[model samples]
Target: MRLDEYVDDIEQDDSVALRKLAEEKSYAVTEYIDDARTRFDETLTDDTLVGSTAPSVFVGRSSYPNVSAGVLAPVGDENDAEAYATTGEWYQQGFSIDDVFERRTGLLNSTRRSNVDVYDVWDGFVGTQREVALADDPVDIELGLDDRPGFDLDGPLEDIAAPRGPRAFAESARVTENPSVPRAIEKTLSDDDWRAEGAITYLYRRGFDVYDINNVLSVGALGEAENRRLVPTRWSITAVDDTVGQYLRGTIRNAPPIDRTLVWHTSYMGNDYWVVAAPGDWEFELLELKAPGSIWNPDPDGQLYMAADNEGYDGRSGYVEETSGAYYAARLGVLEALADRDRQAKVFVVRYATEAYWAPVGVWQIRESVRDAFDGEPAVAETFHDAVRQLVPQLPVSMAALRRKSTMAAGVQADLSAFGAGGDSSRSR
Candidate 1:
């Protein structure tokens, strides 16, 4: 019998497939570091510091008018600083959460509390801002700090596992040497009236990735005068995703549909994803399965939890509360792939979070994983429902539950009924 026929047995009793999932989630440590716990040893002292390229910026989320904003650079050789936060390097090397934390924990953040609307050049902070915003390459910087910085490891969902280094309130910062800036970025920054959204879209079209754009925005480097402010790091992440996704959606609004039902599957960092692209309009849905004992569902005796949210052809005006940032990030990846093919489709993405995904790596994993999933050879089916059925075995959740939570699946089922009732239409929305 097919796997679905034994759903009851699989749910109540241990199965081979489930055992395999458990094994995959297990981590293999080659060696243990005794100093791993000593890394957090912070001394409450201040002194002049020099570091390399500006890898990132952090905007603290607290207090309405006054918030802490900082530039992040690793305390290491100038050349290695660029590699510290490079997402491509991290993904290419197959670095785990601990590997990332090991590097990130060494970064020294020079911060200052300023009004959210403080975009004008200041005596001390402006120099740091200019270097971070416009530098084509990492530059040497000297910083004077008030005291030994505190470690910040606090964040939501995915960011909760991110390692943060020591942060000190900045007394002053000065560049040791002038750094080269990209002509395009320099021009955009020169225009004080340019809107942040426009600047982001322009740079993205010019091949600048979201990582670079978020840093710039967080440093208050974009947007028109009177509208510019330091955006919190968490907020900037979603902003960039939303901005890029919107741009892609505009391009595919009138595009043609794909030729057939396509199913693509990929997994990384313990999260498994199956995406179905069916010939239709630009509608999208995300169904998430958090298995019991998974990071998100830590209780071994707890039942599995499934959540989903979707948008229609026109897209949503409000936030996607259920899936949060992953919704926009994954949606952008799908839309970009569809736009590249010059075809639009009703996209359904199903994500399975197993115990293997014990650590949070942020939403970039979702965005990139879904994007890479499209690179593989797809399994084709004649209809949307057929495609879902073909891929259902990969998920631990029951089909009945998935259908209830997946708007796209229900639409496909309804269209099937309409076809049987003598109506010839197969597309929904």
Candidate 2:
């Protein structure tokens, strides 16, 4: 029977698929680490790292007002420093989870304790770090560390950043060459009266990706000169995503809505994404189901962990608490896709994390997954409720569970008794 016509109770078993993917990922990670170690030089037993290409800068929020401002540079392949920089292009290049880990693990974060205010301070370690962030390409740098850098891979993973590698306290940092600054960025930097939000929107409209904007914003490069202050990299990432997402949302506010309900699906880094776009005014919801053994839900015997957050046509007033950064990342992706089509949608995006998603490789994948979800032809449905019913059995959670967490799902409970009287259904695929 067609999924929308008949309701049934079914549980998906992805154990075999998970096992195969796990084995492949394990092999790839091991091989990548081995290759990296071969190219990585350990001779920096001294406190100085020389001739490294500074690809990015990180501002840590560990101490609040007093932060850890640092530069991120590749240790060995100094010539290819730009590859270590995080960008959405990594997704376009088809970077696997292991590839992301390997790239991030190759760069060392050299930091120095400093106040969050660095808008006018330019001549020291912080200045050098800002220069790297402002540069269009990797800048050659020399870093004098307080001690030998520590390489530890056993720390807890981050949802907003890739697996970072070595770390050290930088006593001094020097830029060896002139970093090329793009004109758009230069213009933003020169505008003393421009607010950060306005500058962010301007940059997005001027063809700057969120990744670059995040980097620049983290170093206190944007905003009115007096109000500019360093922002932590983690905060900057989500901030840029949200800022740009709001811009895209405004761009599509007056556009026509989609004519039909469309469903698209894609998988990346062991997570499966299902995006449903229905004809309506602007609305977005993200529903996440993490398998028991997934990174976020690590207890093998625990129940599935589900989280959801949503916004109406007017947009969210406060931050999304349950889904956090993933909400903004995924929302930005859907909005970008909608903006390109010159249309708006009531977007419901579901992410199912299988046990194979063992590592937390940050929220970039979430953004990329939804952005590319529309690449192929989508399943068409007559109604949004029909689309939800069609995908219910394939989800890890039951229809009831989804309805509990999803406002949109709850609104369509008129046929409750019909859906409640369910029968067993075979796997159609």
Candidate 3:
């Protein structure tokens, strides 16, 4: 069967879709695992390089006022490891989740317990921070580990097969050379009064990508006052995505809306996404459909699991409790495309997770997939409901079920009711 025919099968039932998709394309989840395990085994006796192209700083969640600050870099040739750090390259190269894990598993995590707010110039943290935050290119470093670290296959279902990197307490670390620093980063680092948020926005506007900004923030390189502390790596990822997303949103606030409803779809690592942009205010919603046998919903006989979250024109001030990091990541991608067209629209994103998306490759896939989806020819419709009707046959759930979970869809229903009551509507088609 063709791809389109397979997609048509998805709307009927999960088992049918899975069976058809499997028959259409041979998916070797075990092959991916074997490749990652082979690469991970090779790293056991090899010396690794951290921060080759870009350094990764990790802040531990424990110890409260004092947390563990660590730097991570892959174990490989200096040039190769450096290239591995660039996520854009990975995306462009079409690297799979297993490929990403093989590289990440080779990283050496060297850590030390320190006060979160400590940024004294004479301390070791300062040296590591400067090297990671200011370096314009990859910086090679040597680490003295207290002991050899072990690997584990334990993680969330989305990332279960990916081997966790080995970690050890750092006895000492020394940079091989003075890293080439960007003047913009140098200036930002010099200014202690600049808040992290402002620095992130400035760097992003200045053409520095999120990966660079994330390194800076993770190492406690930004923020005002003497209270600047290392942000946990997980937290920093979401923070940078959110910060940049907000910046893009601000630019499109007054921009003209798109001429019509546009729907774009793409899939990566077994997660399928549909991005729908309609003519209206800047409302947004994300609806996720997890197949019964998928990782999040592991019951073979269970119904599909659906979850959604949304926000109005102003966006949400608090965290997106439903989607977590994925919300910000996907939102950033959508906002970026809208900003590029100099247009604003109410966006409704629908995601379908099949059993094939068995392993998590982080939210970067979502961000990039959504970004790329907009590049395709979109399916256009005259109304929001019409667009949903058009898309329903391609999705697993019914329109009524989607409407019940999606605030934006609910809003559409309310709009229809209001129009019926008053006979005319102010919302533009």
Which one is best on lDDT? 2
Assess candidate 3 and give its lDDT: 0.70
Please give, for residues 1-429, the per-residue lDDT of candidate 2 as tens digits: 333432232223444555576657656655655555555556364536556898899998998989999899988888888888887788889876677878977888898999988789888998998899999999999888777666654433323233667788887889999989999999999997999999999999999888899999999999999989899988999999999999899999999999998888777877889898999999999989898777888777877888899999999999998999999999999998999999999999999888888778788889988888888567778788878877876776666667777888776554655343322212110
Q: Give all candidate RMSDs, comma-separated.
A: 6.9, 4.3, 6.7
- The reply for model 3, stretches above 4 Å from the true place, is 1-54, 154-163, 412-429
Which 10-residue window in model 3 sums to the lowest lDDT? 420-429
TM-score of 1: 0.83
Q: List residue ranges in candidate 1 displaced over 4 A.
A: 1-52, 152-161, 412-429
Model 2 worst lDDT run, 10 consecutive residues: 420-429
RMSD of 2: 4.3
**Model 3: per-residue lDDT, tens digit, 1-429?**
323333454443443544554343224444433554465456544453223333555677787667787777665444675655636667777766556655666566677887767555435744674586568866777776656654554443334543346577777777767778898887787788988888899999999988788878877778875856677767888999999999899999999999888777777767889888889889888888787666677665777777777888998989987888888888999999999999999999988887655556677788888888888767666677766656765667655555667887765543323323311112100
Model 3 misses residue 149 by how many Å?
A: 2.1
Candidate 1: clashing pairs of residues: 53-138, 149-167, 196-223
